[model samples]
Target: MGFDWSAAAGTLEVVPALERLELLAEPVASAILQLDDERIGVAEIDPELADTAAFCEQYGSPLELSANCVVVAGKRAGEVRYAACLVLATIRADVNGVVKRQLDVRKASFASMDDAVERTGMAYGGITPFGLPGDWPILVDAEVAAARAVVVGSGLRRGKLIVPGEVLAELANAEVIEGLGR
Candidate 1:
């Protein structure tokens, strides 16, 4: 909480997340608050820089401290299932290897942008692990949950949320796994 934004490696300008990210979906905001609102911060950014690579490069967020929340959809016995996967920016989610087996589905793939955005009530490229459907599992890479802090979307392209990896580990139904990211 003593971060000197002015001296931040990337010139990060942090504000209390609850104040600047009012547009966050109900669930997303609640998740951050559940972690002790004061522990998280918000940084405004060009909507175009919301993606991990651009945001990290522009905001000075390190790839190792940035995480992506991806949605995977699959079917087993004509029953559809979806899960949210959290992986560090430095690696990709091992969808075919781990995700399929985890979901107990024969196949799995990234959900289409249209469906993900519509169902999550969050904009494309700004989906976070917060507020996901209750039945869906949130699979987090072990390394991601152990990070000091990580940057993730704020449910909108206009900003990002800074939270400690421990906050992620506490997420409802979060399953931390080894080799989840590769």
Candidate 2:
């Protein structure tokens, strides 16, 4: 089933933005389409509201209906390893605790904005877990995976994606973690 964008995003229409999905970052668009999940919907939004709080408030969506994907980096045996952390807007990713432990690294920190934007090929405020690098493990919080539908970035500031929470859990390399969000 598709997302009811009229109710979730207020006036936004659910369109076949995925038909032109290449407009999104290459990785994200490919994942969504290739994953074979039919509960995904795409919609446009004002770039100004791309940030979670602004997007949720402006679109009349609750914080719980939004998920934030952050890029994190750490070093293990002198090799840098990066991963994507997905959590609801209502909670924070346990980066230093659960995340570091999960990565089996001594230290973990959010990637710098320049690194995140340049490497991911997505705007700083518009990074989504869907299009992350192949080697990056997508760490999804249990609560986020339990939601019926979630509003996430479209890999650009001008749009957003609506997908079933279970779909997020099914991404390649996705690791659904309990206590990942705090």
Candidate 3:
């Protein structure tokens, strides 16, 4: 049978994200207000289950519909570059290859947890592209951008956002790239 979000989400209630800004981190809430996408929704969750695998398992959500946003930092010519890569949970972001090249840095790696949280104003395990700095690039994996709907962090461990993939692809700084996730 096809996935049932209501059943999968268990006892957690999914509601219009804008209606529950209190459940989202400040930055995420602000971003959602700007997005004005009615398709976006939010659900309360256990902060302890913020990680993709754990969240999916605990909520009975399909892993394929989970989107992960990772923060990457690269240094080139004494300048540091940061970007957010959004990919499906079933695969990994090609950080060393695609991300390194995209950032035009000699090396690319996951940003330190402290750095990521500080820069994005989001919890370490709950960073999402929606509230990232305006200057930061948001790399959207082809597969993730093609999904009908996906679950992603709400910029805090206490909640998650459900958004249509096309909405992510259309974000102001989003760049849909092939082979971003592999």
Candidate 4:
């Protein structure tokens, strides 16, 4: 069957695995649903596509057609820690340079998969900026945000959320940035 937001809403059930893991974020889900451009579709897929290339190929969608939101852990000189960063599937965030500079941290690294899962309330490979902590620094690729619509993580490894790109930025309170290299 084709995706229907209303029907999906009526069901309104978090995937069993996500629920059991306690990884679903209600605020993120609700924020995504509240957008005015709410025509986005959500669907689950095979686990193999958790990586960008496989996901694009399997779905017949371009890597440029999707946005990747990542959570990076930064430790500042003063001992403060934070998660940040977002990019399109076609590009990778400059973790050691730009991201570190932005966060004013000497070191920045991708959050460990377990740490990402535990703190973000999202499964590994399914973390999106949608329901992330409001204080986190969210960066977005200009091109991805310019798309009419783009697919993003759905808080579960096996599912994705398709929505207007601009709306996704709004939901994440993200700032558009440049120089995300492929």
Candidate 5:
């Protein structure tokens, strides 16, 4: 059966993400239009509850159904590389291990909040993989890609996106990596 967004929505109302572009960051809205995927939906929420734990608690959503997209920065010699790691909120991304190796860098760490926000053109708590720079790789944990449906940031503090996991697997720059989250 398809995901029952209504049941999982708690007191929030969900509508087609494409139909509510005003609620998303510009890049995210454009990406959603380009993807033209109908299964994506958006729900408005209080900005104060944008963080994973608080959002899930306030919305009555399962923790397992939430995904976090973290921006990582790695430096090799004089060059810096960026990647987005998508993993289940219940676990942390293996930033210094698998991701570091994958990026082929000496050190890997989460980008500074200011840097991440500036680079992604999104709010501090709302950076999402959907609208990341085209040149940056997106590392999606296998478990997240296999989930039925997941709640992710909408590139805006006041909203969230509901999407089928397979859609993330199909993004052009996405790589499904096993054990990306640990």
Candidate 6:
């Protein structure tokens, strides 16, 4: 089925425990003013597309497409100190050694849907680096900064926010890092 943003907009219900806020609408561009903090801007797009290239082609705006990757430490049976990484669509996160070293955990792994949603207060497939816990390290791919704007999650599953890269960095308190290769 094609992405129906209007339909998604209709399902804006506040999740009780997470208290995560959601905004539903067309593909936003540069600055999600609705967010009071103005940290990261969100963009709405198809969740089915697994790769950034596909998302870019479909949206006709590669510069605005970013991949929000959540890296957890306790994914291997049992662990803790989960971390999330937000990178530009043009690059991939270093899920192996780099992420492990950055998070300073004995082992780092991708978080499960339940863990991600519970920790970040965002829905599965709808998590954004914005508004995440301050203790969580937010890393941005250097390439994302080069773009005039970048697209990130809207704290919801349906729509996305396209906002300035600087704004996202400011909001997430993200640190610009390298090693997002392949």
Question: Model 4, stretches more than 4 Å misplaced?
Answer: 1-27, 34-37
Measured by TM-score, how close is model 3 to the native structure? Answer: 0.94
RMSD of each: 2.2, 1.8, 2.9, 6.0, 1.7, 8.6
Q: lDDT per residue, candidate 5, 1-182, as tens digits?
A: 43456644666788889888988999899899999988888999999999999999999888888899999999999899999999999999999999999899999999999999999999988888888899999999999899878888999999999888899988879999999999
lDDT of 2: 0.83
Flag regions of model 1 displaced more than 4 Å: 1-9
* Pairs that collide, model 2: 28-131
Estimate TM-scores for all models.
0.91, 0.92, 0.94, 0.77, 0.96, 0.66
Number of residue pairs clashing in candidate 3, backbone atoms closer than 3 angstroms, sequence gap of 3 or more or interchain: 0
CA lDDT scores, all candidates in order: 0.82, 0.83, 0.88, 0.65, 0.90, 0.54
Candidate 2 on 50-119: residue-level lDDT in tens? Answer: 8988877787887887899999999999998899999999999999999999888999999999999887
The sequence of per-residue lDDT tens digits that candidate 3 reaches over residues 1-182 is: 32334532545578889888987888899999998767788899989999999999888788888999999999999999999999999999999999999999999999999999999999988998888899999999998888877889999999998888888999989999999999
Q: Best to worst by lDDT, what's the order?
A: 5, 3, 2, 1, 4, 6
| Cα RMSD of predicted structure 3 | 2.9
**TM-score winner among the candidates?**
5
Off by over 4 Å in 3: 1-12
Clashes by residue pair, model 4: none
Residue 93 lDDT in candidate 2: 97
Score residue 30 of candidate 2 by CA lDDT: 77
- lDDT by residue (24-111, candidate 6, tens digit) is 3221121233344333333445567424455555665443345565645533345466666777655667867777777766666688
Runs in model 6 lying further than 4 Å from the true structure? 1-57, 74-79
Stretches off by above 4 angstroms in model 2 are 1-7, 20-23
TM-score of 2: 0.92
